[model samples]
Target: MENYPKSINASSLNDWYNSEKEDPVLIDVREHSELEIACFPKEFLHIPISKVTSTYVEELFAGLFEREIVVACHAGIRSYNFCQWSLDNNIVSEIWNLEEGIDGWSRYIDPSIPRY
Candidate 1:
């Protein structure tokens, strides 16, 4: 892919999500057990990284257009990798990795979100 993809920190993402006319789709790629400790307050789709398959992705994104997808994980590494994978497969026009992941959100955006 020609594009290197992009990333958004918790602060910028929070602001963009609230100020923008269109809401970006926040997806948590962390394992289910990790969510029990802390979770993003906003509405998001939970899709474990392990279960991500071409078929599942096609079905999940079916009928969706011009969607802004933001992938998140524990510390951002996994999410960043996912972003690369998305781009490699040409899954979406735009995909952003949640830099520092939920841990960043907990540290920078909301302290209420427990950090493991």
Candidate 2:
């Protein structure tokens, strides 16, 4: 598979969902306070950006090196940054950022969810 950190948009994500038969890793990188403002899929794993240091991030993803990871954040900036970092650091994982993030999600995708 191609390196995932470069970028991945929402529309492409829909295709990925359609094409991929298995459940990929979904990681939420937002802060706790931000999460209070908006929530993601219940299946998502919380590994806040605050804890994305060399130690913590490595520890958090310790056993999931081979998983396909989709990194999400409030607006997608942090998740994009993390994707780049992960790629640069030689962590072998696929990462996709939800373009527009929860804001876009609330605005265009699903309105039932509250927006911050």
Worst ten in a row by lDDT for model 1: 58-67
How far residue 47's Cα lies from its native spot in candidate 1, in Å, is: 0.9
Candidate 2, residues 1-116, lDDT tens digits: the string is 44657455655555666684666677888889888878864478888887777777777788887777888887788888888788767665566677777776677666777887
Write down the lDDT of every candidate, Cα atoms only. 0.87, 0.74
Model 2 has an lDDT value of 0.74
Clashing pairs in 1: none
TM-score of 2: 0.81
* Candidate 1 residue lDDT tens string, 32-109: 999999999999989899999878876786655477888899999999888888777777767889999999999999
**Candidate with maximal lDDT:** 1
lDDT of 1 at 78: 91
Tell me the TM-score of model 1: 0.93
Q: How many backbone clashes does candidate 1 have?
A: 0
